[model samples]
Target: MPEENRTANFGRGVFVHDVVIVGAGPVGLFLACELGLAGCSVLVLEREPEPRSPWKADPLGMRGLSATSVEAFYRRGMLHPLLKASGVNDYPGADEPTSPRGVGHFAGMSLDPAKVDVAALPFRLPSPAMEGVMSNLEAVETVLSERASMLGVEVMRGLTVSAITQDDEIVVARAGEHEYAARWLVGCDGGRSTVRGLAGFDFVGTEPQFTGYVVLATIADPEKLRPGFNLSPAGMYLRTPAKEYIGMLEFDGGAFDRSQRPTRDHLQAVLRRVSGTDVTLNDVHLASSFTDRAMQTTTYRQGRVLLAGDAAHIHSPLGAQGLNLGIGDAMNLGWKLAATAHGYAPNGLLDTYTHERHPIGAWVLDWTRAQAAVMRPDPHAQAIQRVVRDLFGTRDGTTYAFEKISGSSIRYDLGSEQPLVGRNAPDLRLEDGTRLGDLMRDGRGVALDFSIDRRLHGSAMGWESRMRYAAGPARNDLGLGAVLVRPDGIVAWAGDRDPDREAFERAASHWFGSPAI
Candidate 1:
């Protein structure tokens, strides 16, 4: 760990990349794919020699994709491949979008489907993209890695970033005896991010309220344990549908040690105490611990270095928002960073990545904290939980929960009064029988004109290759004549029947920069 050891090759044979990403997890690989798709040279450095782990394979490795995440993948043409690999040909309730089955949960409270109002989510389509998809972490990472490799991204395994130093020109990262240089560096290395620590990013947030566990073990008497989520006087225990997967949350103020691998004896003791049953574990396959210790960096960017995923913010995986939020970060940052690297970005474009995503990160942290507070094994929490349970049974309450958990409620402040302006643009079907998302596979801004207004189509002409222009009739225009969508699928501008040339130009310039001439 000495400076001499970390500084083996300061300048010799330093491979230059447009963007050097640290970590090869789902977030890093997804970001690499996005950047590479935009024609940016990307190199991903992974500390692990191989990308295989029991905790990241199946059962315990399953992650739920929110509506926004599904749409993001669909827009990029990655959803079909991921779904095929995950063996989920279609999402649950895909045939019937209005099934009363729970789509997600808040803490331990299920988001009741009966309470959700489909009319409320106007932007949501009947396609499978609106529903959550369960995918194994290993499968997702594999899909991303394959897509990234096809896009010409270089990934080096077993390379740990020990030190990172950046200046005005480039950022240099040292991984053992080699040095890698890039115009921008991003840390997607999870909660204990080396890039975040070495780059001196200031992370601040609340401490842990409980210690949680994701265990895969054999039970001698499975009949003693209840199916699905169970809350006892000791703590909470959740059994996945497969029955071999179990999760326990202890209100131990995060006293559990994570550095050492958990033992079968320890797992049995905790499981027995929480489930209040004498369930004997025959064997332990995989065990990992987490805490409700929520934290996030004050700023996601520091000079030429940036942070995303668990590297920028972390909280308990109560509502399954961690993976969704990280994917959102990658989708948002990839295009802007690539544009900045390619010298086509408008002023403050790169900075918008942090500004737009920081608030969302803070909300998710507070969300986990609130869920932890309500799930505590105390008199006050129990009373609160009873009331929350009743609320979940109500229509408004369930709709609210779905909005936040599904990422459908998120809307950035794009300085527009229109509701759809800063939200995810609805997937529209054009007159040519093509879906709007299908056109966005190339990763570029889209100027959608539904009214066949020549003026609106002409508005995006100057932007040339940076923005694609399309005008046609749609199955549903939502009463909007036209709209401009960013690469990440967020609506940047919208208008009614009448056209505003100057106003349209202003919105275009704000997002895609001034006219080429």
Candidate 2:
């Protein structure tokens, strides 16, 4: 570790930053807690000399990934009981364990973002650094290494990068003997991304139907194995174990990815088919593995090095939707990389993170290859996965895949959003009694003051000084009427009716190109 003693400068003089993440995991510690709370100046690096425990490594892909993006988790303020054990739980039940080939009956026909339709607001949007960077990745690397040390952000660790160049605006980096420099460089490194193979980009796609072995172990009698680990019309299981073992296991698809794990005798025949019919697999304490993959990187950014999460898409944990699409690619590329490193955007908004997370990572790997083609073990695909898991149970047809990809059904086709074009801006539930996830909890970007709707006289006070302007009336709480909210909560203008102010200042200058009042 020499190179002139690993070139110190972590946060001493405080010059180098407008962005500089490398690998802090969970989308580079939620994009270094959203570019250090948008004041900018960040630096992560990490080679994992520490952080993320319970012997860290595997533990992600969170079954269908979305507990409101695990309460904005980027180490949720360094771990507040991992955000009080990420609230709401009865743990798996849409027709428990049935997979002799029936996939928990389409999880009882899916739908339940508390009952979609502008989603019924089950609450989420909190992100103490995404619950302290997904605590247990060594408590998200000790809450993003002490939130990159009290938000000044600069990690370093076993220093590695190796090399990188740039010029025409300084980029340089080298690590493993230090060199560093940055105008912008982020490659949340993973999915074997050596900075997307030294910025050549391309992580295209393919592979992963099975690789096997996935057991997270943890069960201290969890109510004497709650009817043998409930959840299995053929998938998902968890209880958030407290003192022993039994609360996680992901085999072929979205479960711990060891390039596709499986085969310690297929995880000892599914831990002896969930320890039953005469259980006996010792009081096993913990197990480990990972390699699961999916691939996605047509581009996250190259000219300055970008890549995010499992290095811009690595799929297969089917509905676990790759760490909830990398915590929505770190809140949609952390406010467009802090509005293109504070120039107020317009570097083509950092090429909209591959025109918006490469079509939500190719439509979440085309519905995880249509739920991995109903896990074809053939026998007519296990008799059509047992007549669509007992005639559509665990919400099988995924409710037509939640009426076509439910990431709350994203829109941004990049069309000049006339009114947030398709709709999604209804975090709903508001009256002055906050919630749209507590008014987007200071991520600092919203303009939703529709004068409530049926248009009226003026009252924006210059759109509340550039943001968070919520004028309730046109509709709220799942009704979604006349809207506009950006500061990263997305939905930059949705409506059922309610307009004016030159089309809300031309959709806030074509969505933040400028001029919004």
lDDT of 2 at 495: 48
Off by over 4 Å in 2: 1-18, 23-174, 183-212, 215-266, 273-318, 338-342, 345-405, 409-489, 494-498, 506-517
Mark the regions of model 1 whose C-alpha exceeds 4 Å error after superposition: 1-13, 92-101
> 298 in model 2: Cα distance from truth in Å?
30
Question: lDDT (0-100) at residue 208 of candidate 2?
Answer: 59
TM-score winner: 1
- Candidate 2 residue-wise lDDT, 1-517, digit = tens: 2222223344433245566788877678777877777667777887867654445533432233343354454213322534434332323311221111111112122333322222222222222221112223444445545654676777777777977877545476788866667678888877777888887887767765444333554333345444323434333333334433333333355444445434344454564453332223344444555433567877788887787777877765545556667767877788777776666565477787778777877877776666656654445655666676553433434333443443545666657545445334434444554445456655665655544443522433444434566666532333444566676566665544445666666666665666434
Model 1 TM-score is: 0.95
Q: What are the lDDT figures for the candidates, one per model?
A: 0.85, 0.54
| lDDT, candidate 1, 1-517, per-residue tens | 2323222334655656788999999999999999999888899999999898877877878998887887888888888888887888645524334533556887676666877987776576555476778888998998898899999999999988888888776788999998888878999999999888999999999999788898888888889888877877778899877778889988889898889888999989999998998899999878889999999999999999999999999999999999999999999999999878877678999999999999999999999999999889899998998999898888888888888888889999998888888898877667686777887999988887887655687677788667788888877777878878889999988988665767778888888776777
Judge candidate 1 at residue 33 and give its lDDT.
93
How much does each candidate deviate from the true structure in C-alpha RMSD? 4.2, 18.4
